[model samples]
Target: MRDSFDLIGIVMPSLLQGATVTLQVAAQAGLLGLVVALVVGSLRTTENRLLRFPLTVYVEFFRGTSAFVQLYWAYFALPMIGVRLDPLQAGILVLALNVGAYGSEVVRGALTAIPRGQLEACRALGIPTWVAYVKVLIPQAMQRVVLPMGNLAIDLLKGTSLLSAIAVTELAFAARQTVSAFGNPMLIFGLVLLMYLVLAAPIAAGARYLNDRTKRYVA
Candidate 1:
């Protein structure tokens, strides 16, 4: 057991290095997803059928499908159609699209949750709609639901494991490679789990801290 642990430790640094890849994927995906979410959410709030119609279809299509299928489409289908993408690009794109679908709803709901009076006040004060949204609505909405976004961030972090299926050399790929060579699957998986916890714990803590601090502000 001690020898097995030592073997796991020997390769752990390599696995940790792979975590950098995981972090890169998740960070890019979450940021892009939030951007997508904000756009779609705002559209959903508006009365425009033109903007709402296409955005609805996009959100539904993404939300309806498995993220793995999207990843496959990115890595495989696009190439078959003569639009090739590298694994990293495909991974990030698919992750962003998938998370964005769900994030859009969160964003829409958050945007809606802001009091109507705030919008009216902003308008009466001669503030631009964009300024009102940025300065007042988005700040309050973000404060109201930091936890959910944090969960999405954590979800994307875990979802990076799926990129391994596309031969991306992220943590999941590194774990599989080490396990194959070492013949100790348990130790390899344990290390992988640990690495995921290491990545996720801080985001969770930060979410809680922000929540607490924001409550202090509101109070």
Candidate 2:
């Protein structure tokens, strides 16, 4: 019992620090991913084939590839071609782009799911295409996408653990370091899981809150 307590005492602080980094990576990546999703997903829906073609390729490429390989490519390969990023930067970029690809699908699906009648009504009323998207399609789509976005947010949060591979010192990395020194994999990893759960709770709650707020709009 005393040994367990001692392990907790030694490990908790390091884990907390790692959790902080994890949150930072997740937050930045989530925000960037939202932007990418909105832009790429929205553009891919456009009537202009010139515009849509490239964006379609982007969405497909990111969505189809393995995120783990993408991370290694971003961190290890990009530098060879003169596009170099620090470990944290690469981790955030890869995660944002990966989740952004997935999020874009959510955005596209939500937007496309809006009834054709509403769009026809907008056109009949002489609403510009952009205005229609902004005032009509997007707002509805946002409400629809909120729950899925929440799930993506949690996925992004969990994905931050992969940053340990690049030595970003996020939660999993910290856990690994603790385990190496203290020789307690089960205890260390159990605590790691708990910390991840703690980190994920807020994202889940925020998603539910946003979903509730948007329910009336969706209805």
Candidate 3:
């Protein structure tokens, strides 16, 4: 018990630091992902085949491939082609792209799910296409996507563990380093799980709050 306590005392600071990095990565990635989802998803709803085809390719490619591999390709392969990103930048970029692919579907579905009559009414009122999407379709879609986007947010949080693969020193890396130094995988990893749970709780709560609030607002 004393040894475990001592280990915690020794490693807690590092873990906290790593948690901070994890939050940073997740925040940047999640925000960028939301942007990508909105752009791609909104465009996908268009009748324009030119935009749809390439966007479809992007969504399918990222969604179809492994995120871990994508991270490696960004960190390792990109340098060979004369594009280099630091570990933090690579981690954030790949995660944003990966999560964005999934999020695009959520946004697309939410947008499409809006009642057709609303769109028809917009057209009938002489609303421009961009105005209709911005004022009417997008807002309603955002309300609908709260829960799913929250799920994606949590997934992005979990996905930060992959950053360790590139030596970014986030929570999983901190845990791994602690385990290497102290040799108690079970205890250290167990704590890591708890830490992740703690981190994820607020995202879940915020999503629920938004969902409930939006539902009330729409009602």
Candidate 4:
């Protein structure tokens, strides 16, 4: 037990450093993913088949594939085509694209759930299309989608662990390194699991809070 405590004391700092990297990747990827979700989701709602069809393909391709494969492709395969990205960049890009593909559906469903009559009402009032979307439609749609977006953010946070496979040096990678050195798999990995719970707790709480607030506001 004394040796285990000493080992933990030695490993915790490195683990924390890796956790910081994990947080950074997840935060940046989540923000980028939200932007992708908004643009792709909005494009998908248009009547222009030209725009919609390609966006549809983008969404489906990401959703259908494994994010691990995507990350590996970006980090490994892209170099052959004269496109090389470092591990951090590759990890962020893959996480963003993967979560964005899933979140796009949330955006689309939220927007589509709005009553057509509401849009027609804006039209009757001679509101410009963009203005109607900005002032009325998007705000309401955003409220409805907030909870799902939060859920996506949590999933993205968890997904950052996969970055270890590509040598991103995030928490999981740090834990693996510690385990190899200390030869205490249970102590290292169990702590790693607890670290993940620590990271995930606030996101889940924030989402629940937003969900309640949105429900109250909608009421």
Candidate 5:
């Protein structure tokens, strides 16, 4: 056991490097989700029947299903259908779609939360609809969503652990490797927990801070 200390030390850096993969997966998924959120949320806000109905269908589809199933579909089924991606790509793609479906609602609500009168005035002032949305509405909506989106991002980050099932060597995968090597579940999982906390705490703090300040834009 004592002799394994050197082994553990040598492995920690590799674990962290693997964790970087987890971080990259989360970041890519979250960013892609954010883009989807913007488009779907805008459509929801605009009330375009064509766009809204389809977006609604997507939201319901993802929200109704388990993320684990979605991951499996991407990893296992899509390749069979000829839309192939590596394990890492599949994990990220599924996560983005899953989270984006929910984030759209958050963004839709944030858009509605902005005072209707502001939108009215933007129209009254000859602001092009797109211009008004970009200059006035989206910023206000962003304020509301920054916190919620940050929370979602953290959830997505933690959820990356599930990727190990598909052979993605992320933080959880690294910990599992550690446990297999040393037969020390406690240490492996304990370190995993600590790493998650370390990664997520700052994002949470930033969310709280932004939430507090965003109130000023409620007008």
Candidate 6:
């Protein structure tokens, strides 16, 4: 009993440190993914085949492939091609690209859901296409996308665990190391599960809050 408590005390600090890395990677990747989604989504809605076609290919390729394979390629294959990325860099890049592909569809759907009349109204008012998108289209679309984006954020959070395979030293990797050292798989992994739940709960709550607020606003 006392020994178990002592073991936990020794392990907790390392786990927390790794948790910080996990959060940092997820947050950075999520932000980058949103940017990619916005760009790719907007391009996809345009009539320009030149611009849309390549973006479509990018979205499809990432969506179709396994994120684990993507991470491995970035970590291992990129170096062979003279692009050496550290574990963290490879993890973030793979995560951002993977989630961005899915989020692009969400963004495209949101933007497409806007009424054509609203765009016509903006055009009749002499609004430039860029201005119309910025002032009228994007705001409304963003409101609709909030819930989906929140879901993507949560997915990205869970996806960060995959980084452990690349030696990113994030939470799962830390837990694995602890298990190896202490030979207490149940305790270590149980704590890891609890920590993930703790991290995810607030994100889920915030998403629900935003969803409610959006509904009220729309009503």
Best by the lDDT measure: 3
In candidate 5, stretches whose alpha carbon ends up further than 4 angstroms from where it belongs are: 1-7, 122-136
Report the poorest 10 consecutive residues by lDDT, candidate 2.
Answer: 210-219
Candidate 6 lDDT over 1-219, as tens digits, reads 898788889999999998999999999999999899988987899999999988999999998899999999999999998999999988999999999999999989997898899889899999999998887777777688888888889899999999999899999999999999998888889989999999998998998887777664341
117-182 in candidate 2: lDDT tens per residue? 888899999999899888887778878898999999888988899899999999999999999999
Per-residue CA lDDT of model 1 for 110-175, tens digit only, reads 777878999899999999999987877777887766888888888899999999999999999999
TM-score of 6: 0.91
**How does candidate 1 score on lDDT?**
0.88
Q: Which stretches of candidate 6 lie over 4 Å from their true place?
A: 121-136
Per-model TM-score, in order, reads 0.89, 0.90, 0.90, 0.91, 0.88, 0.91
| lDDT tens per residue, model 4, 54-158 | 899999999999999999999999999999899999999999999999998998999788999888989999999999888788777868898888889889999
lDDT of 6 at 10: 92
The model with the greater TM-score, 1 or 3, is: 3
Query: What does candidate 3's lDDT look like per residue over 1-219, in tens digits?
Result: 999998888888999999999999999999999899999998999999998999999999999999999999999999999999999999999999999999999989987889899889999999998998888877787688999989999999999999999999999999999999988898889989999999999999999999887774341
* Candidate 2 CA-lDDT value: 0.90
Local accuracy of candidate 5 as per-residue lDDT tens digits, 1-219: 775576668668868987899899999999999899888877887746887787889999999999999999888888798998999888998899988988998988987788889889999999999998888887788687888888898989988999999989999998888788777677667877888999999999999988888767556
Query: What is residue 159's positional error in candidate 2, in angstroms?
Result: 0.5
Predictions in order: lDDT? 0.88, 0.90, 0.92, 0.91, 0.86, 0.90
RMSD of each predicted structure:
2.4, 2.3, 2.4, 2.1, 2.4, 2.2
Candidate 4 residue 207 Cα shift, in angstroms, is: 0.6
